[model samples]
Each structure stands twice: as C-alpha cells, then as structure tokens.
Target: MNALTVNLRSVLELTDEQFFQLCQANRDLRFERTATGELIIMPPTGGETGNRNARITQQVMNWTDADGTGIAFDSSTCFKLPNGADRSPDAAWIQLARWNALTEAEKEKFPPICPDFVIELLSPSDSLKVAQEKMKEYIENGVRLGFLINRKSRQVMIYRQGKEVEVLESPATVSGEEVLNGFVLNLAMIW
Candidate 1:
C-alpha cells in the first residue's frame, strides 16, 4: 500500500510530548510530522528494500565505529528538525561532541537537532522527487552533507552545505568527502 499523509493543519499543533505519545500508541507504524503538522504514516518497505537499507546503514555505522568522530543511526531514529519537521533519514550521523551535548531526556525522545550527515536510499515505492526534496530539507536544517542513492537508476545525488548537488552515475562507491573525514561508502551491496 502507498504511504498516507493526514492533514492536521487547521487544528492546534501537537506538542512534542503529544506526538511522542501518538507514536507510542501506534508502535507498529512509522510516523512523521511535517512542519505544518501533517501526520505521515509510512508503509513498511519490501523485503529487497529492507535488505538494501540494512546494508547501507551497516556500512555507514562501520565507518562511524572506526572514525570515532560521530554516532550513527538507522532509519528508525527520528530527529526533530529546526524547521519543526520530524525526520528520519535512512542513515544518519551526528558529531560526537554535538550528540554528547544533549541531555538524557532530550536524547530519549526525538532529539531536537539535525544530523551532521544523512543518507536516503530510494526504494521502489518512494518518489525520486520527494526523496531529493527530503535530502534538500536535511541540508537546509543544518546537515553538512546528504546523499540520495537511487539503486534502480544507479545514480547518487550528493548534497553538501553551500554547494550545488553533485550527481554520480553508476558509481561503485561514494566518498564521504571532508564532512565525513576520509570515510568511503562502498556501494557494492547497496547497488
């Protein structure tokens, strides 16, 4: 089934705590809030998509483990963006110091901060335009670098702060560049 968006724009916005409760009440579903307070209910990905997502997160987390400069998160970890949207990228990273600055309570809920680096893998059900726009939103919300990987087309879109998006076609691997400090994403499993 396709994902659904429910508009709650006319009503009072849900507080972060209220949103958390709503999510808790619906444990099996993935929920997200748009800046304007629309509730997004995402469908679970297909088996192949799930496998690719796992490999993508694994590679990124491995890099974070070795680099020791940041913490990595899989798709389930949501962040309350500065623009008021709650977003969960496919794979995300935050610098160690920045993550450490949050209080335990803040960390427990959707952390009210953007990730330093974000990646979105385009599944068959996802719209390429929407995914690219989400990547742009991450960049706008203070993420230093973002990657939009499309396995079907074998194209990857690189988004960097203050720079034009760089697109790579049929790339076997992608560099994390200065933002990730020498980490490289081997796209073999993902592709």
Candidate 2:
C-alpha cells in the first residue's frame, strides 16, 4: 500500500516528546513527520524489497565498520532533521564527529541531525517523485551525499550539496565520493 498522510496541524501540534511517545506507543507502524506537521504512515515492504534492503544495509554497515569514520543505520532509525522534519532514509551514515556530538538522550530518540550519507531504495509501494523530493530535503538539511536508487529502472540519482543532481543509468557500482570516503555500493545485489 502507498503511504497515508494525515495533516494534524490544525487540531494539535505534537511536541517532539509527544511525537516520540506516539512512536514508542505504536511499535508496529512506521511513521514520519513533515516539517509542516503532516504525519505520514508508511507500509511495510514485501519480501523482495526486504531482501534488497537487508543487502543494502549490510553493505553500508560493513563499510562503516571498516572505514571507522562513521556510523551506519538501517531503515528503522529515524532522524530529526534541522528543518524539523523527521526522516528515515532506507540506509544512512553519519560522520563520527557529528554523531558523537549528540547527547545520550538525543541519540536515544530520533537523532537530531541529518546523516552525512543517505540511500533510498525504491520499493514497489514507493513513489519515485517522492523519493527524489526526500533526497533534495536531505541535501537541504545538510546531508553531504544522497542516492535515490530505482531497481526497476536500474537508475541512481546522486545528490550532492551545491551541485546538480547526477543520473546514472544501470551503473554496476556507485561511489560515495568524498562524503563517504572509499565506500562504494554494489548495485548488482540491489538490482
């Protein structure tokens, strides 16, 4: 199913703590909040999508472990962006310094900072346009690099701060550039 969005700004403005409590109470549903106070409920992925997501997360996590310069996160980790939007990229990585700066409580809740790198793998229920918009939001919120990967289209949209979006068609691998430093994602597993 596609995501369902609810505009709750008119009735109630959810405080950060209230939102966190709401999320904690609803453990089964994945939720995201827009900067404008719209709540989005996302559906779970299918088997194929889940497998691909695992591979993508594993690769990034392994790289992060080896690189020793950053921390990696899976889809379940939501981050509170600078613009007040709560986002959870499919796979994400944050520089060690940025992550270390967070207080223990901040780290316990949705991280209060954007990731240095983010990857959004398009699932059957996801909209490419929406994913593209999210990538742009990441850049705007200080993400150094972002990728919107479409397996069906075998395409990857690379987003870099202060640079134009770059499209790669059927690339076997995509580099993390300076942001990730020596990390490369193998698209064959994702495809």
How high is the CA lDDT of each candidate model? Answer: 0.92, 0.94
Model 1 CA deviation exceeding 4 Å by range: none
**Candidate 2, overall lDDT?**
0.94
Evaluated with TM-score, which candidate comes out highest? 2
List of clashing residue pairs for candidate 1: none
Residue by residue across 9-92, what tens digits does model 1's lDDT show?
A: 687678989999989899899998888788999899999889999998999999999999999999999899999999989999
Per-residue lDDT for 185 in model 2? 96
Give the TM-score of each candidate.
Answer: 0.97, 0.98
Q: In model 2, state the lDDT of residue 25.
A: 100
List per-candidate RMSD values in Å.
Answer: 1.0, 0.7
Q: Candidate 1 at 110: error in angstroms? A: 0.3
Error of 1 at 9 (Å): 2.5
